[model samples]
Target chain A: MSNKVIKYILILALAIIAAIVIFEFVSNNPDKRPSNPFEFNVDNYKAVDETLISYKETRQIAIKDGIPGAIAFSHGQLYLLVDDYLQVILPGGMEVFKRKLSEKPNCIAVDRDGFIFIGFENRIRTYDKVGIEINLSEVASDKSHFTALAVSDDLIYVADAGEKQIRVYDKKLQQKHVFNGESGVSDVHGFILPSAHFDLAVNSDNELWAVNPGLHAIQNYSETGRLRGFWSKSSFENDGFSGCCNPYYIAFLSNGSFVTSEKGLVRIKIHKESGELSSVVAAPEKFSNGTKAPALAVDESDNIIALDFDRKMIRFFEPK
Target chain B: MSKLQSRRQFISGCARYSLGLTIAGVIGFSLTNASSQQWLWQIDPFKCTNCGRCATHCVLNPSAVKCVHAYALCGYCDLCGGYLKPGHIARNTAAENQLCPTAAIERKLIEEPYYEYHINEELCIGCAKCVEGCSSFGNGSLHLQIRQNICVNCNECAIARVCPSDAIKRIPADEPYLIKGGFEHGQTL
Candidate 1:
């Protein structure tokens, strides 16, 4: 072959290789590339509407440089579990009493007689009205990560998200029965806890209402661990629960309505006992973006109190 | 013809023929292997919704997903949108001032208005909090990508099962990573 022809062929090959390299480099550069249509943006956040249950923010109480964990109401007063301390406050936002605790408290419950039951990482500690700690080793287990606590006149229910079961105890704190939402309960498949967000609340009839977060359902179980009934609906609209695990926290009002709080969307809504959508207490725009799940509680006057974790404040909402 | 001339011609022909055959064989093998090889698990940053599930849904105690920074795209601003909160007043390393819950992103002062940020992969929980802040408020440089070395590559990834946005996907093994701000083609890490 002629030298001129050979030189032309080599130059052609080099040009092709350079074009391929440049094409690959430009195509792979995300900034120079076309924007993906599926990219999610936090700026597009839209708060859902407030329907049947309209709420007006009546008050806000500061937690004194602490993040609120769990909240409960007893004896016409609010009990807030903050960082290593339980602060007791009145309905008008006055500090009644405050006491420091040894272990970090995840959840709290108060009995009819004002006895406080605090749930730690793996055990339950009881405190009398006078702030004396009561030791209950029989009910304590390292295998449990107690995320929610509920006290009835006869039985004490502990919602263990770690073990995916509810442990029942008597007034003496003796382990009575274990309900995992499995076994003989045909309708109750099991609790689907994707994270440590499982919560439960006791209604006026002392029935256990556990938040089946994964399914976006509230399950009703008898004291004997029998699956009674449930109310659930899944939707992205304002009326229904949204996200993987929603309504992470639950509380019951005096009229048997449910006050629920969700995490990802960060909203509080009220639902009828039969799972009917009532009204929105606080919309997503009410709280800061990326707010964690707020602790929820309902007092006798039907006022909804939210322990805002992100803002570190205890806010009260009343029916308008 | 002389014997030496004939022998030289014969050897030249054989060498040219073998070179052609070798080139053809390499191209054919690469084409066939590229089509048949299985892909590994990867996260497409474009599809990720940052729902905070990547931190908890992984089979591992701490997820294999880690934040990767595209230095080429980064502005390297002293007031980094990813490192500081939206209304942060001071450019200090205080726990309350930083955006990351775990403080995984380390910031170094490069100059008066430029700072270099590095990700501590061990401390990252795959939450993508900083990525969200950076993308929404500043240059979209920081993003989440699954670390194949750390990922177990389960048949059905636990994170994929619960990912709300379905961002996790199986990509060709030849092109294992989907790095931002660069085109890798079918190159392997």
Candidate 2:
């Protein structure tokens, strides 16, 4: 071949290689490639005004020894689970009684008859009004990590986040049924507990409410383990729950409203029975920004009690 | 084969040489500009929710995000909230008693009640567990900052994509860091 022809061939090859390299580089650029624009606006909800919730701080109880874990209100008293001890305190922050547990308690529930149900790592324990321990671990699975407990007139529900199932029990603590994602019921899909923050509460109408954190939803289930319905909002707005898994802890008010506490954006919010955001019980500024979700409970009078994990205290808020 | 033909050939050669030099110069200038234009990832501390995504979502094996101690804000207490777990009884330096899962914070006795806490950046996973504890109970001195040297400076930072609070942002090469408390005096380190 001629030298001129050879030079032209080499130049052509170099141009083709450069074009291929540039094409690959441009195509792979993450910025140029179409991506789902993150819809949630973080700046809009950064600092919400505290006045949105018209509630007054009625009382504050300092928990000096242990960090607050789980909280419940029953029989006109407050039950606080701190470390391995369960302290029963009066509404005025006076300690009425305290008892130690053999295992670390992850959650606490109170029955109408003054019975206390404490859920440990692998089992459940019941106690009578006089502080007598009753064994209930026989029905628990080996891998159960009970994160929340709910008690009704004749039923008991334990939220095992580790197993991702809600174990139903009778008054005698006998296992009745296990509800999971594949429980064969249409709306009774299993729990999506990403972290150990699953929580459930029995509302005034006796309907069981469970938090499906991964979906950012508050689901309602019947006593028979059938799916009733669910309420969820996933906006960065104050009305909705945001973050990986939030509204981690939930409680029901006397009027069937839901009180929820969320981590990451640490705030306490009150939602109507229809899942409409009624008011803010406490703003994010009221609590330290870095604290986890606070344990929440509502008394019979509709007073909201928050076990502030950051401050290590119980704050009572009453409607203004 | 005349003298004029020879002069014309010489001019043609010089013109070709000039064109080659111009092309080379343009390529070199573009390469220099591309290399000089550097970008660094910065986290706006106020916007950071401490969601713990920095630890797992980073491109590096161990996250480039490290817990930075704002010495100006640190109290340096013996019972440092960032160093020890809440309700921890012992004041000694033990692995189990420390709040940090990786034990990255080093506590040294500077005086009677004061202690000097240093972060071992190599061991930090940027989980922000210590930052949470410190901000909640003690002074908000401990915070997470992405180290520019360790970061690969990805075009689209993985952590920023997943950050729930939208805290991460890109800054110019001159201002590489967004250290807390350093903004008042323009300190980058």
Candidate 3:
């Protein structure tokens, strides 16, 4: 071959060798990345101090067949909404009755008469203890979502997350007046429901309280749409509510303490009547990965019942 | 020109024709039935560790992978975790307090407290800084996803090969995204 031909072959060979070496180097060392100056991590928030947790796991009841929806405690019995079925279970885990429901319900509340009031997406339905349909309310409006229901002596208050307002109903499930969180009170921006996690509960005094989750506080309101008082604390510390919206779920203890559940950090806490953090019922570490807060309810005995959707069970927690 | 020579020649011709027919059939079948089942690389948001390798390892200049917003799962908060950096002093849309390095997130006040967020795909670098902050502090409405329209669909995904948690997976074309949803979808993470 000519000298020029030999030189051309050598150049081509050199380029091929260089290409192979570069590819091998990149594929073998995957961690040779550029340093990141802007750093943030969620793992730092996952750990909770032992001193903060004040409750222990007492017992757990497994729901095997269907997806657990919500739980309500009334008259020493636990009413569970699972799939399209409403089941009643005793404190000892003995099932009282299982009856088919027409459709899935967003929430459930039981009155002193043991009549279960079911909240669908936009309307309300009531059923007797024997599973007989008592009454059904008219649809609130277009695109109304009833996320929570609370029963009083003569009124049933519904927290409509869609409308971002509270609706009052008569004993027959007939719609009465609506409270749109406009108390005209100073600094009172009324229900700041960012998502569908708004909750409502009737205290022992028949007083009405609603969770203004976006504000990380529960507001006390009268049946006549007046803001009486509220207490709020937002912090990453154990004593305060954290995340975009917290106190995602709530139930009242017999003594009027608040059993609250937070979603983003996935912790359950008890707050005193004045809205001071009482103690930790369950820490972030207690729940499985990808889990937020579970649906919360307190029985007559004040046992904190957490409906664990991730674990497919209702966990009972008592003060340690 | 013997009988043995004639028989050998005929057998060779028959074998060559059979091989040609098989190759043609395979090519035809692949064209007809392989479109719908085509697989695409996606990040499983549940398993992703937010390692920030997606922005570095992609072959493209600006990675085809971008941030996705699930509005149904969003809280529409004024203090949005995905849009603002941690320890933010003011909740305004100041360039300094934003989490995204590229200024890809757009925030608008829909009402007194509710804010709507939109992703400007042209500016996103798939750095996952916003995703990390959102997943840690909020309902996790913002997550990383490979944009189908922008992706070149390489034979081997560069980011997937170097993923630490192995969160990247080959999902069907019909279901290309792995968006995170709440209990109604039977998923929390």
Candidate 4:
């Protein structure tokens, strides 16, 4: 063999061996997920009560606990969503408490006595006013993207994003009734995004006013799961449904008047009795500028408590 | 002729050994470099959109987002502008007057006149309510930082990529932070 040929062969052999060793080491070591899985023991969670820390002279209110735009106030206490955790603001802002649930909480509601019920990802958890978790139920039969929830008296209503149906459950968590996307029944196909800002509210008439944001209307249903009526056609032209995802949050006032927050235009409109919008609570100021005003509640003073998505804070607004 | 052939053979053997050594050294160098290189996610706070999704959408339960304070530039008052709401507390401490929603921001009396504001990151949800107030009223003393201890360090962190502010950036794990003064974005450098 020629000297040059033999030299080239020896160099190639050395390179191959080196390549093999490097490949072996690289293949042996791989990126692994965190070995310490996060523990969800309720004990690991604590509440940061803003109310206790400092004093305010003008507002006279001491501290306001942080709440997600998805919150419900019951019996003068605040039930706030703080990043998957639920916090309850006590009266006088004295004590603030929290409960870490097994699943992320999307919406919360409380009865007269302050029993808290939370819904998220096709699951429902009922907690006492003191932050004690009571019941956890997987309601949606197919786990079909449970989006919105509303509880009244002894019944709990759920909106499924996956299926175009609204399922009703008794206090015992039994499937007493189900409303498919019928004329009167609210469904994703006929109403709003099944997951949009809790589209369901139980009114004094024992009828369910389900806000169908996608449909830009409110479908009414009797307690017996009967189709009663619907308000879809808007009286005002520009006042009609504003966003592709129409009314995300629906708020009802004392005199049976109500308001809806539109997503696309980022505005809030008041729906008159004739199924027309005449009052503009918050007009669209800019494009895609609207916050996630998903949860809406009316305080005793009739002020609106809205979860502002852009602001990342709870905004308090008075009706004009 | 026989002597010439022997000399040629010897030279070939030495060349082969030299080539082999050179090739081996090159391969070793490449392998060493590959093992030491690391992949990381960086945040450019400048592009951050301040989307509320950071609070809820993270895969981590608490979402590694935390509230950070710039103490060097802090106003250091008994009543911090960022820590308290728009109004002053009654001549004393009142729950409704404070600005912190979760009460995660703790205050300690550093002196009779100066106060230290510390954030309990575990309890902070990264709502940025304090950040808004501080930057607006105080010297932007409070800010949000993605804590590495709890961060899962995903192959592609959603917040870092989506941040409209472009405030996040990857730093070496050994020295994994880019500290700033009170408020640097719009405030004086």
Candidate 5:
């Protein structure tokens, strides 16, 4: 063969070999794979428009153990349950009271009278302003997990995720009634808590709002277990709760707006009383991937107090 | 024959033997050791939707696929989403209370608020029940992977052909097993 022809053929063979090697490397390597074909991408829900975000993180108080359980804001005093201590810190960042509990608290709530109500796994313990254990109530049931607590003037409500019911107690911690969400109303879907993320909050009107996470709705029930009213939005959109269950925690502003925290695509959002999207408090970027939802509480000044569970810090936000 | 003809014949004989050895070496290399060039069916944990086909589609009676735990990514929650059934009342060892149908997962208390979970591959049916629960509620630490020892390594994987998520693909069998790297989507190899 001519030298020119031989050279061209050799070059062609080399090119084919290189192509085969490249193809094999790119096709077989997991890193070179394309974006997942069946990905459940709810990442778009994390993005928030600048105009819709009404709150900005102003400060963060890192807990001592760096492991926060739950938080409750009452009368400008921040009540944080971290490790085994119920720390009551003033608005000025001064810890006025710190009580070591018998065990780690699952949830915490403070009434207007400065009574701290702590919910353990299966029981409720109340401490008066003088740090005296006022009431110790054993929530009787095998499957009674006290996930959340809400205190009103005359009553205290506990969300039992295990039993999927709301246990109502009087001021003396006596079992008043059980609201199982089974009522004459046709719209009541009851409290469907899939995981352990059930939450309870008393709004400005003293109406108990329970997060039916599985239904992705906030339900309102009377002290007698009557379904009063509820607001729910279940979707992947900014206004709705997503995933199997969400809106892990919910609080209310003085203006009666709802502040909610959700898992999956972790976000802190505000909703109107009528369940309309008000504004974004903190978008998903504020949290790490696979982070549990932050515990939500609005202080006396309407400052949004978010206990970032993954970060182990208390982040305070204010309306823009 | 002339000297030149004898020399040409000797060179031709050496070239033929060299070519034969090269071909034999190539065949031997492929038969014993799977070189990097080989392709084997593997499930990408990132793309797997846990559609429940891995257990049924495999030719083996007990499917080769199994659930794996990424210890680094585990949250060690007392109420593990992977170990316990959804809306489970108590964290116990009851078969009905467990998420796994085969009861393959063994849960041991690590401390007050943490628990460690281990999967028994013998009983695991590759149903991906635990993987789905963990991914949805907790960290996506529990992921589905094909056990190489159990896999017969079929030329055409039955599961791959019908993977709902199309997560199963032919990967280089250089790595022992596909493990869930983390939330970042990194792979071991």
Candidate 6:
């Protein structure tokens, strides 16, 4: 072979040897595996301090589309949520009734007489237990995004996100009074994005509890609209509201204790009957990876119900 | 002329050497980046709907979805909200009350006052029935979160965009989780 041919072959041989060495080095060492991507490792998962109760799968509730926002039960019937409508099912998971509407239904309530009241965009839709639409009334206020519904005797309380107050109406849909805002006396207008609105049941002394998550406090009130006491004041540390939306949802346990779900910091708190604060749910180690629970409901068994904003799943919790 | 031809040959050799170096550099960079940042599959716990899609919807045969326990948040009740039916047992632990469809969450008496409940990740099929029970009735001690190891980490997480509360978020790998303190006897270090 010529000298030039030998030189070219030598260069090619050198290049091939270099490539083999580099490939061998890379194939020998590998990267470490990711930690708990499925969130299955119990040793590292957070929220390890609270008491855990018995939990089982729900066979009756099936979420079809979008995430479920609010869940309620009326006359032993279970209600799961979709974006545009509320799906009503039997306790055995039978699809019995569905209330179809044009807009999204965020909050739902049923009175003692089996009257179903739902809060939708800018209006409240009332129905009999049979899923028949009764009345659809538009609130006179603008930017009135209704999110919560509560029925106390003949009075219905609607939490209007726009007006920033619990609007009071008679069973027949008459506007009787407004609890907060420019015209109300109790100054509950101080709340920030009060998403789930409700009033507690009347005690033996005819007392009730109402919470404004925006203000981070629960107010005690009488049927006559008297401000009796404030249960708890929210502090911005060690289990308090930290996000722009403030407290998203609240529910009362059977023992008179209550659970509050907050955004930003994203923790579920348990307040004792004496008003001592204890954290039942804190954000997981993978913080800010999940959305807050925007709405809450307490079943007759004192189980706390929350709709996870991120997962679009209906979550339940028992008091520790 | 022979000297001139030799000089031209040297010039061509130099140009080829430079071109090979540039190509090698580009290939090296691409390979390093490709293998280094491959841990992509993740579940946005916030956006997951607990629809049992994790059990059925994953591209993998075993479904990348697995059950996760937020142990710090658990209440450790005898009749755990996530483990039992609301009225199935009269405030006690039993087979009739557990919510796990595959009986994956196991409970053992750790001591006189405390019970240890754990999920068998291998047996878990990602049906979030237990998570729903815990979040609604109990302290939300048991929740469904994606394990990154098994996740394929698609360009778009199938469950994240559909989330109602928008709870799912991307976190860094080193300090990956958002730890919360929950129930008694639960430890987070």
Give interface RMSD for all predictions. 17.5, 15.4, 3.3, 18.5, 9.3, 14.4
**C-alpha lDDT of residue B66 in model 6:** 73
Q: After superposition, which runs of candidate 4 have C-alpha atoms over 4 Å from their true positions? A: A1-69, A90-96, A135-138, A183-198, A233-238, A285-291, B1-189
- Candidate 2 lDDT at A313 equals 91
Better of 1 and 2 by lDDT: 2
True contacts kept of each: 0.00, 0.05, 0.38, 0.00, 0.05, 0.00
Enumerate residue pairs that collide in model 3: none
Clashes of 4: 48
Q: Which candidate achieves the best TM-score against the true structure?
A: 3
lDDT of 4 by residue, A1-320 (tens): 99999999999999999999987565433332122121111111112233321211121122244445366767787777776788776434454887777777777777666778777767677788787887777557654656567777878887765565687877666667776644433321344341223367765444577776544568777656566777774221334553224566676666566667654335555676456755655444421333354357766655656666565555556643
Writing each residue's lDDT as its tens digit, candidate 1 over A1-320 gives 99999999999999999999998687545456454332233333344544444898988987766767889888988888878898888877888888999879998999999898888887778898755687553635666889999988888899998788888888778788887774233554477654455798899988898887656678988887777988887654566665445777899988899988876567888888888888889887888875376888887778889889888888999989
Colliding residue pairs in candidate 1: A28-B183, A53-A279
List, residue by residue over B59-99, the lDDT tens digit for candidate 4.
78766877788677574654354666643433124668666
Clashes of 5: 0
* Ranked by TM-score, top first: 3, 5, 1, 2, 6, 4
Residue A308 of candidate 2: its Cα lDDT?
Answer: 89
Name the 10 consecutive residues with the lowest summed lDDT in model 1 chain B.
B180-189
- Runs with alpha carbons beyond 4 Å of true place in candidate 5: A1-40, A183-189, B1-63, B66-149, B152-189
Model 2 per-residue lDDT tens digits across residues A18-62? 999998687556555544321112234656766777677788889
lDDT of each: 0.78, 0.78, 0.83, 0.59, 0.80, 0.58
Docking class of 5: incorrect
Of the true interface contacts, the fraction found in model 3 is: 0.38
Candidate 1 at residue A241, lDDT? 64
Score candidate 6 by lDDT. Answer: 0.58
Backbone clashes counted, model 3: 0
Which candidate should be chosen as best, given lDDT against the real structure?
3
lDDT tens digits by residue: candidate 5, B1-189: 545567788899999999999999999988777544767788889888777778877999889999989887675655566777654545689877688888999888865444778999999989888887678666678999998888888988988876767788777767656776633454534
